[model samples]
Target: MGKNILVLTGSPRQGGNSDMLADAFIKGARAGGHTVAKFATAAKKIGGCRACEACWSKNTACSIQDDFAELEPLLESAATLVLASPLYWFGVSSHLKAAIDKFYAYTRPGCKRPLKIKESLLLICGADEGLGVFTGAIETYKGIVDYMKWQDKGILAVPSVSAKGAIVHTEALKQAEKLGAEI
Candidate 1:
């Protein structure tokens, strides 16, 4: 049976490099018989986590309502979670960061809430090829996976691609598809 994959993409620019990579992965994952659902974080109205702990007291997932509320159910049902984002200042874009921060709500002590995702994949695109350009984003994802005890599926970091649709000429697109098929 195929797995349910939830993709959260963070790219303010539509058809940007990171979004292209996400599309490639989604195509491949779908071709491989996996069900894929993608949400464009940059286009959503999600906000930063308030840390009010109201979710714990109210028996809710998140207190500050926004697009993240819409994703809660999908997050719960997905078996594989894919985070695709464009590197900004050697870190993840704020669009994606906001949603990731809300994950803390689910980790409240004795919350009894557990993410259904068992595996995670990271896909990042950046313009600079500098050393450690992708370090922060990768580590952030790693921290989440480790804390959640989810398997780190893999990472695809495509550098030197700044312009939108630049990834169309690169082999990374094909490789991304292949990675999806493998999953």
Candidate 2:
């Protein structure tokens, strides 16, 4: 049986470089028989975590009562998570960061809720040509994988691609698709 995959995209621009990479990955994942669900944080009304520590107190993933409630079900059901984003300040965009912060609701001390995710993949794009530009984002991704105890499926960081649709000229898209299929 194929796994349920949840792909979270951080780019605010529709059909942006990062989004394209996500599309390629989704295409391959679907062809591989995996069920994929995608959520674009930029298009939602999600907010950063408030650090209230009141997670699940009211039978909700979060107490702020926003779009995260809509994502809770997907998060709980997904076996693999794919985070695709355009690197901002050497890290993930604020939109994706906010959604990631809300993950605290599931891991708060004493919270009984469980996350079904078993593996994760990262896709990042940046304007800088240097490969080092992706260090911050990669480190953050690594931290999340470690904390969640999920397998590190893979990471595709394409540098020097800032213009929208620039990724179309690179081999990263094919690599992303292959990565998805292998997953």
Candidate 3:
């Protein structure tokens, strides 16, 4: 059986390069028979975690009362998590980071809820031209995967793609699609 995949995109621009890359991945994932849900963090009003330690205390995944509450169910049910974003200041966008911070709710001490995610994939693009430009973002992704104990499915970092439609000129889109399908 196919897995349930949750794709969180962190690009503020709706049809930007990273978003297009995510779209390709989603297309391939769906064609591979997996159920995929895409959440655009930049478009939502999700705030950073408050670290109140009251996770699930109010019978909710988080008590912040924002779009994260809507994402809680998807996070709980996902068998695979895909984080797609554009490199911002040598790291993932603040939008995606906010959602990631809320992941603490699941791991809070004494919390009963559990995340079903077993594997993860990463897709990142940037305006810079070298692989070194992705170091910080890759490190952050590695940290999350390690902490969650999730299998690393794959990572595709495309550089030198500053313009919105510039990714079309590169092979990253096809690579992302193939990775999604294979996953």
Candidate 4:
């Protein structure tokens, strides 16, 4: 059976380098017979975790009451998660980080481990080719995977690509497609 893959694209600009990489991964994942659902969080209304600890108390996943309400169930149901973004300040974009931070709700008291997803993948891009450009972001995601007890399916960090559509004609796109197919 095909796995359900949820792709969270964190790039604010549509058709940007990271977004293109996400699209490529989606293409490959679909070609590999996985059901892919993507969400562009740049313009979404998701907010950071309130640390209210009201999630389990209120019997809700999050207390902020924004786009995250809808995303919570999706996150629980997905079999795989793909976090796609452009490296920002050696970290994830604010948009994506907000959504990720809200995951605290699931870890609140009485919730246990909240996510049912079993696997995760990372697709990150950056302008600089210097060492450790993606280290922070990679470590952050790896930590999340460890906390969630999910498998780290893969990480594809493309460097020297900053502008929109910069990945076109590059081997990165092909690699992304191949990664998706392997998934």
lDDT of each: 0.87, 0.94, 0.93, 0.86
lDDT of 1 by residue, 1-183 (tens): 999999999999988888888888999999999999998889999998987777756455787778888888888789999999999987789999998888887777756566788999999989987547898889988999999899998999988888888888778889888878888
TM-score computed on alpha carbons, candidate 2: 0.98
Please list all clashing residue pairs in model 3, or write none if there are none. none
Give the winner by lDDT: 2
State model 4's lDDT.
Answer: 0.86
- Model 1 off-target regions past 4 Å? 56-59, 110-113
Q: How do the predictions measure up, each by TM-score?
A: 0.94, 0.98, 0.98, 0.94
State the lDDT at 102 in candidate 2: 96
* Tens-digit lDDT track of model 2 for 45-141: 9999998878888898788999998899899999999999999999999999999999998887665668999999999998899889899999999
Which regions in candidate 2 have their CA more than 4 angstroms from the true location? none
The sequence of per-residue lDDT tens digits that candidate 4 reaches over residues 18-123 is 8888888899989889998898888798988877777755466876678877787678778999999999999889999999998787666678437778889999
Order of candidate numbers by lDDT, starting with the best: 2, 3, 1, 4
Residue-wise lDDT of candidate 3 within 1-183, one digit each (tens)?
Answer: 889999999999999999999999998999899999999999999999887878887888787789998898899999999999999999989999999999998877766678989999999999998999899999989999999999999999999999889999999999999988999
TM-score of 1: 0.94
| lDDT of predicted model 1 | 0.87
